[model samples]
Target: MPPAHAVTWRNGFKSAFWIANVLELFERFAFYGSKAVLAVYLANTIGLGAQTAGSLAGLYSGLIFSLPIIAGTFVDRYGFRRTLMACFAMFSLGYFLIGLGGMSAGQGLVQALGKTGYITSVLVLTAIGGSLIKPCIVGTVAKTSHPDVKALGYSIYYTLVNFGGAVGPILALQVREGLGIEYVLVMSSLVSLLLLLGTFLFFKEPEVEPIGGNPRTLGQVFRDMLLVFGNFRFISFLVIFSGFWIMFWQIFYSFPFYVTDVLQFPRFELMETIDAWTIILVGVPMTALVKKWRPITAMTLGFALASFSWLIVAGSPTVMAAIVGIALFAFGEATQAPRFYEYVAGLAPKDQVGTFMGFAFLPVAIGSFVGGPLGGWLVQHYLRDTMNPAMMWYIVAAVGFVSTALMLLYNKFFAPREAS
Candidate 1:
């Protein structure tokens, strides 16, 4: 009944794909929803310094992004449904405790744990939960999609991710403005619970091969990591690539405080929302335009554009400048993000694709760990002390350009080995 050599949508995708994506959407909704206001909550509610708050945020996000390196093996052993169940439970409990962190009712535990301790525990819980969720959902997509349409399946997965990201901030901002910050956390908890319920009711394991062939044992996993780390060129490329994430994370780590306390922007969360929206709007089209370019060229251009975007904000503190800056930064993000993945995929040997892809998150993790403190320092030193807030952007811009140059050098000097 179908056209020759073409699979119908109904036949190409299994129900697992839809279910996995739906779960992914809600998981991101909860994560980004909480992330939208986490920095402000840390700085204002708990009375921490800007620098300290940024560092904690960075640690939390860094762990969330990085832990997936080891989490996939665990999922491969334990199965997606069980891992997802635990993740949802952790997310629910973590969000609830985060909201509870603000309550004045628990005087005894508050005194015993201390504010920073309480917040850090909650962050750790959330990060661990998030780390598990990413791999499970992504792995599910891979397991379920027919090979012929796998690329389209991933495209759908990414689109849903960006959509959830865009919607999460807007929802969080509205909830925070309308009710209170505490309620926002409560909302995230509820969303996680909803996903947990969905998983229990609907999710079914998909048929797939053992991950990367028969799943590697714990010792084998460790050995695989050691082998991947032995590649000097790969490690260096990741470190250089990490510089971009350091610059990227400033939006979440420092921008809220910068805008509210210094620039007086009423709705700072809009910056994050705009970023997600731009990704959704232009990601496909831009990726299409540059599909033919070398990965290094795309990555270099992306870093350069993102680096320059900050200057627009630095030069003028006005709302219009902020819009222009964020928009340009979004374009830069679209340009580089897919190419970065493609480059990483190319770097992997046939057998180590999963291992290499797992390591791809290393840069994001490194960026968050280093970038958090760096952003905080920029704010505390330049904006808070000198009354020269725009100076911070200059430094950030410089970091981006430096990263861009490093990538170019890598391409020029290191890349030739592959061709040769």
Candidate 2:
């Protein structure tokens, strides 16, 4: 076989790879677009308190990350194309219902559950749909790309993901400003509807040899989950790593309220866009620079950088400062995010690498679950009650600092030397 460098990108990847990635781009676009304004919409338009809105938003995000484990199992059972079609269908319905609930228009169920409950229910539905996307896209990439060019395939995937993330919020800003916040959900629904059609028309399941032989039964999947959870070391690492996401999630959970409510900034979503754009611009070079570092060491540095970024905003409470702070945080994210999976794979038992990797998303779920209420409380206490909003970022930065210190200690003590 020729060396990977000899292979042309056009020859190394199949049509399915391109299709899957394109779908992933718009899926992310739909998701982030709605998410950019969800907190503000909940608090301002739907009449939920800041804390309640945060909690709901957190619940939605947490579910989106957490459900993929089970959802992946379903994808394995059902074909990818069929599962994707169902997922997009749910996405369309869920987003539309959320918008309808926001407008106080649903008749039977909306009236029965009330607006808050209806919206919450729809959010959960939407999250379930969102859960199916990543596994399908990733599986397609793996199946469709030649072994020689799989890494490049994933690089392309990551670039599109960031591109979608950057553009989604910009679009959200336009939609929210021109139409209304609730129409953001409508926009998401429309995007999903288009994706549903695209999937039906263009997406084909990539054929590849199954890894680890035939698919396991749902019973076996559950058993594997239990076995993974039984590994105290793995579980402990996941719990510790969750601190980064807890800090990271604040950009969405609290930063929106801080920008609009505290700084009187109208384009808070634009600030959110800065993080994605930074990652897109800096991620490749940053990855190249740290390609030789130990995973734990890189992660420790990333945690420290992300933590310190909040202090930048806290020191100077202005739009430029917020922009700079978010950019810094994105740099930290770009540094550690790729290495995280590498570290997890190294830590896993060789026989259960896939199982362990599946559980790696746990930290994201845990972070959202915890960070939401914590962010809401910070906003309430520091931003609203005490009238000292800068303290909120201080607390956020402190959380990152503590997490970074813990990571350093973990590297020194518990981390395998190979990983460290």
lDDT of 1 by residue, 1-420 (tens): 767767755677889889999999888887888888887887777667778888899999999998887777789888999899889999999888887776676546656898888888888988898889888988888888888888888888989889888889888989889988877888999999999999999999878654456775778768878988998877888899898999889988888877787778767778778788988899989999889987877888889999999999899987778778988999999999878877877766767787777788799999999988998788788877778888889999999999888888887788544421
C-alpha RMSD between model 2 and the true structure:
2.2
Query: TM-scores, in order shown?
Result: 0.95, 0.95
Worst 10 residues of 2 by lDDT: 101-110
Which regions in candidate 2 have their CA more than 4 angstroms from the true location? 1-6, 107-111, 210-213
Q: Tell me which residue pairs clash in candidate 2.
A: none
Candidate 1: segments with Cα more than 4 A from true spot: 1-5, 209-214, 348-354
lDDT by residue for model 2 over 282-321, one digit each (tens)? Answer: 9989899889988887888888889999999999889989
Q: Model 1 lDDT vs. the true structure?
A: 0.84
Prediction-by-prediction clash tally: 0, 0
